[model samples]
Target: MLGLCMGLAGVVWAELPAPSFTLAWTHTIEKIRWEEDYRVTPSGLLLGEARIKGSGAGMEIPDGAELREGAWHYQSHLPPLQPLRLGRTPEAGDYQLCIDQRCRPLGDWVGPPQADRPALELWSCETGSGAG
Candidate 1:
């Protein structure tokens, strides 16, 4: 089993059962839906795949991406991310975190967004120490 930590500024707020999961949201600027699939590993989180409903500013279709079912999909070749930063704002809407085919608002895991702490950090719990 893999543990995922959700936190703000090095203070953990929650942990989730994370063998693999998907993080999805609508682009604040383009309003297009985007989804990324990630696999939890001992070292970090591996970005396995990504898909976008449409392309717009900052949403360029990457090389090797293929259009399928009205969306662009591609595999991510980047190195494992030790910590993935997600910026949260009341206006931008909640990020959907999907695990085991069930989706919920990210706040369901990390608690409500704090005005002072504007970013939520996610990483494999094996990689860092934080109280939950």
Candidate 2:
């Protein structure tokens, strides 16, 4: 009985925190806009451009530059301001995105970037609830 209990505990330890809803990767915008240049440090954080595609005039951004970036929120924690560069494209894949300081359609992405194939699925837990 003790061995079985230990085995169960191990499984739980290896599991990631459960999320309520999973945010699916709808599309990738091919470049955004930023008025001023931003910089973020390296503390397990990434700095790049957020490319959003599909809009009325073909493509558009919140501002009107080619890159715009705010604090990236992961799960519910905001590390630091990461630099938002231009040109670099994130590989397509499912990622967990959450709202942080700045509010926008594309939220901060979690996990490694994926390719343009295989729809990306982001997970998030509902407020005042647990993942069952």
Candidate that scores best on TM-score: 1
1-132, model 2: which lDDT tens digit per residue?
000000011121111232211222343443322222112222312223344433334543445434224522222234432211122125532233222333222322322333432222222112222221
Error of 2 at 45 (Å): 26
lDDT of 2 at 55: 37
Q: Give, for candidate 1, the lowest lDDT window spanning 10 residues.
A: 123-132
Top-lDDT structure, candidate number: 1
- Model 1: per-residue Cα lDDT over 1-132, one tens digit each: 467888856667788767799999999999999999999888888999899998889989899999999999999998988789989888788899999878899988776666776889898874234443
How accurate locally is residue 99 in candidate 1, as Cα lDDT from 0 to 100? Answer: 92
- Give all candidate RMSDs, comma-separated: 2.4, 14.8
- Against the unseen true structure, what C-alpha lDDT does each candidate score? 0.85, 0.26
Q: How accurate is candidate 1 locally (lDDT)?
A: 0.85
